[model samples]
Target: MPLTKEQVIETLRQVNYPGYSRDIVSFGLIQKLDVSDEMIRVHLVVRSTDNNVAQTIKRDVEAKLKEAYPAAKHEVVSEIQEPPQFKTTASETAGKEKFLAGIKHKVAVASGKGGVGKSTVAVNLAVALVKLGKKVGLLDADIYGPSIPLMLGVDEKPLYDGKKIQTIEKYGVHLMSLGFLIDNSEAVIWRGALVHRALQQLMSDVAWPELDIILFDMPPGTGDAQLTLSQSVSLDGAVIVSTPQDVALIDAIKGVQMFRKVNVPIMGIIENMSYFVCPHCGERTDIFDHGGVAKVCAQLETELLGEVPIDARIREGGDGGKPIVAMDPESPQSKVFLEIAQKMYDKIENQ
Candidate 1:
């Protein structure tokens, strides 16, 4: 017996967003549906960037369809809607004049939640861009949990040249972070206003060299720090990082919406720790389950820049104050970072 559109729809109705009560079919995520003989094709439009949700929906839909008709063949087509465009205001233009004067592009590495390796992405991305022969600078704007210093192996305090503070140079990229100023044991317990002031100082007071790009390692969340940075500079765009999980995707969605609200162009999404490859046996494992970020990016109409699998060496490199891209440029992992960097550079250049 041939499959029917109603049967396919009913099958899809079994799949739901991880944290939501609504099913894919009921949410109007099914943009197009076709049924012919034993074959079925579905075009799905999802709004969340959670790769797991999308994969789950696709898997369930296909599985149920096959269960109903053993001879059924099916295909799922997904489309992500682009975020709404926001017009820049006069004040926004004025804000850009205060900092980042000579830099060609300023990009932010952000995430909805912490522990998604946002800083690691920023550090390696900056290093990758540098390897591509472009000058770059990295600013650790995560005042409370600044890890840029540890990741880049920078320990000395920034020097002052009377006119402005001098950034430390390492691996062909300039660096700045609150980690350089305060003692590692001490906590940044300042109020929101104080945090903003310090960030302002980092931008306006630093004697950053003329460079092709500056990447800000932003703190996680849609908080005051993010707002301050977005409102303080003319950010070229933002790259969101997330893992292939529902919790992380929920936050990633918030981060994307926040950037859109503030008028920062979203360059794309990157899935960090998308999967794990065992060293001894070379077996692949979806440690956190995969494809959530890709689905989210599709729904948001943003690019899925690339995916970085879970590797022990990546963690070891960061702890040793060396990013994989700089320490092992020829490694497969390093190539991933370089490729993502190239995509970003191309996007900025084309813009």
Candidate 2:
């Protein structure tokens, strides 16, 4: 029997990338797969620059296919994408530099995995900074799942002047997000190259006002988008957000290592949903296993800036398109965000 595309995909699904739970096929690594007359041609793009990782993936694909079809001829074409370009002297790079000239600092709030409240942290941190009397801008770089527009209560589409995009403002923070550009039901099905281009435009083409700092709400994982942002603009530092669970902490380590490899300074880690405070009695419970983040931070020698308890008000505020800091600045949950923002600002100032 001749090999089918479905069969080939099923075989390739067994090939997992190093250090990640997702396989190559599901990770969007298998760009092209052609099978005809027992000959299989596979084209894949891996995000890592490591030659060993690429060779391993190639070997795994070929081995799996050969095992499935003894008479098959398999050809694996693999390419490693170069990291984002950072040089600013060249004419091509000069535009990117000029785009970021007005902002004094650029910080990325990132996580190695999803469901860590990374975007929530990014939004509140930006708002808290605004409360502290600094001119701030927030860019939602999580193209696949942008939530800043919803979180900040901005539902209207952004207006673009001929040359630059006009950002929507709410609660004293200038905001831009992919959510504002597309309808809620619309899905973003962009390739790595297109994603990189969209992110570049989000930073450079947006008519961002002069500000003390701009916070980038980055998408989860150490993939193309993360690399694109780190390379395209000069980042002052990055803040890693994670829950206190062992699984989240494990992935948070990867987030730290990724920033270090890109030469971006680690601002510190924020443990979100660290605990739950009973509304009736005010008793704090270790809902997700407490102190895991602190232990990881100690081992990594990075500061554990603060811990935000799991609060229903926080969730409600986010769902209502109003962050806690902006909705109720006097609340305990809001104060936590404010303190983290101040710590971050102080660290940047001292450095």
Output the lDDT of residue 74, model 1.
78
| Best-matching candidate per TM-score | 1
| Candidate 2 accuracy as TM-score | 0.74
TM-score of each: 0.79, 0.74
lDDT for each residue of candidate 2 in 1-351, tens digit (9 for 90 to 100): 666899889888888765445688876889898888668999999765466677888888888888887787889988876445333456645544756688998999999999999888898999999999999999999998998888888888889888988999899999999888888888887868999999988988899999999999999989889989877887889999999876787688788888877778888999999999999998989988788777667656689999998998888888898899998999999999999999999999888
* Whole-model Cα lDDT of every candidate shown, in order: 0.87, 0.86
What's the C-alpha lDDT at position 241 in model 2?
97
Q: What TM-score does model 1 achieve against the real structure?
A: 0.79
- Provide the global lDDT of candidate 1 against the true structure: 0.87
Worst 10-residue lDDT window, candidate 2: 82-91
Residue by residue across 128-215, what tens digits does model 1's lDDT show? 9999999999999999899999998888888998899899999988999989989998988776899789999999999988999999
